[model samples]
Target: MLVNGFYSVVSWIFLALTVFAGVALVMAAIAREDAYRAASKNTKQFWLIILGVAFAIMLLVPMMFLQIIAVIAAIVFMVDVRPALRQVSGKGGGRRGSSSDGPYGPYNGGR
Candidate 1:
């Protein structure tokens, strides 16, 4: 009974990590290519491949070593790359009094 309970907890943890990795992969894909270059990070294509492989490993293998690598990659992208990309692309960082226009056009501030 105790062993089964422990395995259940472990399984939940693994699932959470896998989901996190998947979210990171999708974010990397949807971000602008030029933003990646402007951020001076790895090319969008390179990160796409890396995150895709990491997500695959999380989904297919679920081995500890591979999962750790995937999680690390996701963390690096989220913590370092995403923020830099956002800054370079003028999306975030809370700049005040900036134009409300988006890259393509202006919205009425969402209504």
Candidate 2:
């Protein structure tokens, strides 16, 4: 009844947290080591270990306390470190464009 439905909701929430941590781990791995230094963040290896443990805790640990701790680590990486790395490395996303540049390229008026 209501208990079953509550458990189902909790399961889905855990699933989402697991997936988020996994994705953060991959992102941390992809960034270059130098980028982290340039961004004044922890070394890439450190973040990888944190995120890796978080992912593992989600899968192997049944304790909600550990899962919450892991989730917090992943969220910090996503919110703080990820943005700094992207800004330093310019590889967080796809092609970049200058402020004046249009969809294709810089547009000039008839001159």
Candidate 3:
């Protein structure tokens, strides 16, 4: 009984994480154009895999593969992509704005 309850709780937690991750991935795809360009194929594939596995688990599998993939993507973002993006944007204590563009404001990268 106790073990079953624990498993139930764990499953729900994983489900929530999976949903949040899916939403974040979608939002990142929308907002971060540079990231979109940098990892266009990988980003699309990642979203498809994560969301497909999430729907499969929610509707069919009950195995939580989506959560696993999401966790892996989160780790990659934190360790690899974040640092690379910081360097690319010159935000690693280097500069507030780069020669290419700034924080997607009204400046328009014109002058």
Clash counts per candidate, in order, are 0, 0, 0
Off by over 4 Å in 3: 35-60, 64-67, 86-111
- The residue-by-residue lDDT of candidate 3 on 1-111, one tens digit each, is 999999999878876766665564554454354653464325544655655455454445455465465466655554565555455555555445656564664466455
Q: All models: lDDT? A: 0.90, 0.93, 0.56
Instruction: Report the C-alpha lDDT of model 1 over 1-111, residue by residue, as the tens digit.
Output: 999999999999999988999999999998999999888998999999999999999999857998899899999999999999888888888645448767666657667
The segments of candidate 1 whose C-alpha lies over 4 angstroms from its true place after superposition are: 95-111
Q: Which candidate gets the maximum lDDT versus the true structure?
A: 2
Tens-place lDDT per residue, model 2, 23-111, is 99999998999999999998999999999999999999999999999999999999999999988877667777778777888766544
Backbone clash pairs for candidate 1 read: none
Model 2 alpha-carbon drift over 4 Å, by segment: 92-111
Give the local distance difference test score of model 2: 0.93
Clash pairs, model 2 backbone: none
